[model samples]
Target: MTLSAPPVPDNDLMRYLRERGSTRNFKTDPIPDAWLEALLAAGQRAPTSSNMQVYSIVVVKDAQTKQKLAEFAGNQKHIIDSPVFLALCADLNGPALACEMHGTSFHGQTFEKGLVAAIDASLVGMTISLAAGTMGLSTVMIGAMRNKPLEVAELLGLPPRVFVVFGLCVGWPKTSPIPKPRLPMPAVVHQERYDASRLPELVEQYNRELAQYYRDQNRETPDDAWTQVISDKYSKPARQHLRQHLNTLGFGLE
Candidate 1:
């Protein structure tokens, strides 16, 4: 039994929830320019930190540009196949300029501020995905772009204080991605205080649920359960170096 795509969102709020699960396979269809503008505009409406809105997006449509981005994104085939690609960046240049124009110091440009900008960028990225989904399009976020941030920055001609948090692949999905299994609310959600006593049992149940979801859909991934997948991801020693690379790209850790 192939897991069905979550039902089409029936209402505005539920529509947002149902419109999740990224799609990679895309058809050879062209996205209309007007709708493309609207999707991006919707992202602008997403909430930001103190309305600072320290985020920017680089929309890529040219085949060569997309191909270069694909190479940076670990050469994901769908990236090259997709009709659009948007690289969301955490930007501080605008604020820096604002301060300069007002002849004021921007002392808040600290490590904490960088994190806030990145969070705002991530929010914008997801909002774009949701915006695309609402317009009958598909999206797949590519975090692999961080695998080579310096190269990506040079390609995008970014200035200092601007960092690409992640890249989002947008297009018409050839096939709907099945919903990934998630831990139940009881397991993930804690009531009044932080609770961990039930964690082991909850994780066990979630692992079982994940394994069966694959069998139900007749699909196969690298691992069957959440534990296995997460373990494998953290298993790599090179993962730790990602942050050092970010520091090299103009983000001050201090």
Candidate 2:
């Protein structure tokens, strides 16, 4: 039997999803407390692995703290300029506490547990971003939060087994940025099986598209913009000390 494709709904949510872009230039307008609470509530509604909810979100509004975080994140001024900075953290501390309450020693130092917590934090962070967008707020995910994980933990007063996986800068947009182009769908989405025969072609196509996008925005970029950027980023050993740092943060990753 041939199954028909489901009808696509053209709605506000769909428009929001399509139009959402990283907001680096933000207005200094404060996010209302009610909206902040709502955003947190939205994050809590995200699905968790085994309902463990092994994640925490540290909200930073203080200018001084945001400045420090900005420095830690390679001096990204958005963290300081945005009204709110959120450190989305992977937290094994709560699970450990639960084990202690049962008079059992926690043996979740394995790589799988570490992965679970990271995934939990990532899911919640994305949810919060989406929710914020719906409320006329824009956000940018700061992966550089991992650049100084130990420092971030100390600054946030995170207990052992807790580390910032990433951060989010949220506020009103000073100006909307053009949504960056993405790789062709087939390049990423595999059908019934994993196919990579078209990867090189797809990458070249994406490179041209991204280069044109940059040109449209009057931004200087290499001809093979996406490919060149990726090459430069990964050519060197990036985040070589992350494993050791995570270990120090109590994620054994064994």
* TM-score to true structure, per model: 0.89, 0.96
Candidate 2: residue 62 lDDT (0-100): 97
Per-residue alpha-carbon lDDT of model 2 for 83-129, expressed as tens digits?
A: 99999999998889999999999987889999999999999999999
In terms of lDDT, the best-performing candidate is 2
Q: Name the regions of candidate 2 deviating beyond 4 angstroms.
A: 1-6
| Residue range 152-254, candidate 1, lDDT tens digits | 8888888878878898888888877677768888787899988888888888888888888887888674343788878877887754666776677667656
Q: Which residue window of length 10 is worst by lDDT in model 1?
A: 12-21
Clashing pairs in 2: none
How many clashes show up per model? 0, 0
Query: How does each model score on lDDT?
Result: 0.82, 0.94
Give the TM-score (vs. native) of candidate 1. 0.89
Candidates' RMSD to native:
5.8, 1.6
**lDDT of model 1 at residue 191?**
95
